[model samples]
Target: MQSQPHVPGFTIRLADAEGGQEQEGAPKATRGFRRRRRNRHGRGLRGELMLPNLPGFRSRSERFDDMVLDSAERLQDMWGKQLDGVLFAVDEIPPNLEQLVAEGTAAPMGSCTPGGRGEAPMVTVYRRVVEQTATGREELQDLVHDVVVEYTAEMLGVPPETLDPVYRRRYQ
Candidate 1:
């Protein structure tokens, strides 16, 4: 039982019959020529668990953005030049939500801000609120489209039904 030199942060193990010293319970050293992969627990090389084209690959916020863009494109096809300078956006929640709740007003699902001082008209939907209000994916898509249409209509000074023929059709 020959004693080994003490190292500050590592435990030294005695040389085995192969005549190479190793750290206690440590993996054997590999040759530099051996390629290392990011495999874990003998699983294959690390990569996306789901394909990029899969629905699960996209985040909720990204999917929400897509819904907004889809609705915007549909509206753009209809309104074209009128929607040219309008901006569509999404926020996690409405600002001053606590104040609105304290004042007995529900947090807004969306808002329409009229353009002024060279700023473009903006429509914003509160993502969390709208998502919570919807029960399923199809419902969420419809709700998001309706919210965008509603705000766009407000900005254009027209009723939502007049702006989009399909507005509120789900409820009817």
Candidate 2:
């Protein structure tokens, strides 16, 4: 029957059978009535607003990767044996950006590295540079494809137009 200390916004109640006092004014939550952790403000769970099947469900980087893959696949079909061991990659920025800037050259959209010492030829697209150059999603996709085509052409020692007919048409 001992009285507990006063707690603001709560009324101390008699001890229950478990020998623990209750706070009468405090919210009582049952197992089934417990508040949701993510939906505290009555909104639904914080998850993807768009369905997985929707185009917007994918992130910008993921969409960019898909664009690169699509371009690579298209090129692969055209040059199967030649592109066999060539690796395609995406990087946020080019490594030699500082040097390029020091030399007063524009940042390259992509780079081509020829294989030597049993290494594979690699084509790397600078994602940030390419994204900055394009105005819209369609433009981004086209630019990504063009960058891939240009680097692939460089790796194979051919002009971009020879690698992809659309490459010449885009500039004209």
lDDT of each: 0.75, 0.73
TM-score of decoy 1 = 0.71
lDDT of 1 by residue, 1-172 (tens): 1111332222212112222337699997774222455454676556667787887877798788778877887787677667776677778888899999899988899888888897667788889999999999999999999999999999999999888998988876
Residue ranges of candidate 2 with Cα displaced over 4 Å: 1-50
Let me know the TM-score candidate 2 reaches against the reference structure: 0.67
Model 2 Cα displacement at 46 (Å)? Answer: 7.6
lDDT, candidate 1, residue 53? 80
**lDDT per residue, candidate 2, 29-103, as tens digits?**
554222344555776676645788887776777677778877877786666667776677777788878999999
What is the clash tally of candidate 1? 0
Q: What is the lDDT of residue 44 in candidate 1?
A: 57
Which regions of candidate 1 fall more than 4 Å away from where they truly are?
Answer: 1-45
Highest TM-score, which number?
1
**How high is the lDDT of residue 150 in model 2?**
93
**On a 0 to 100 scale, what is the lDDT of residue 116 in model 1?**
88
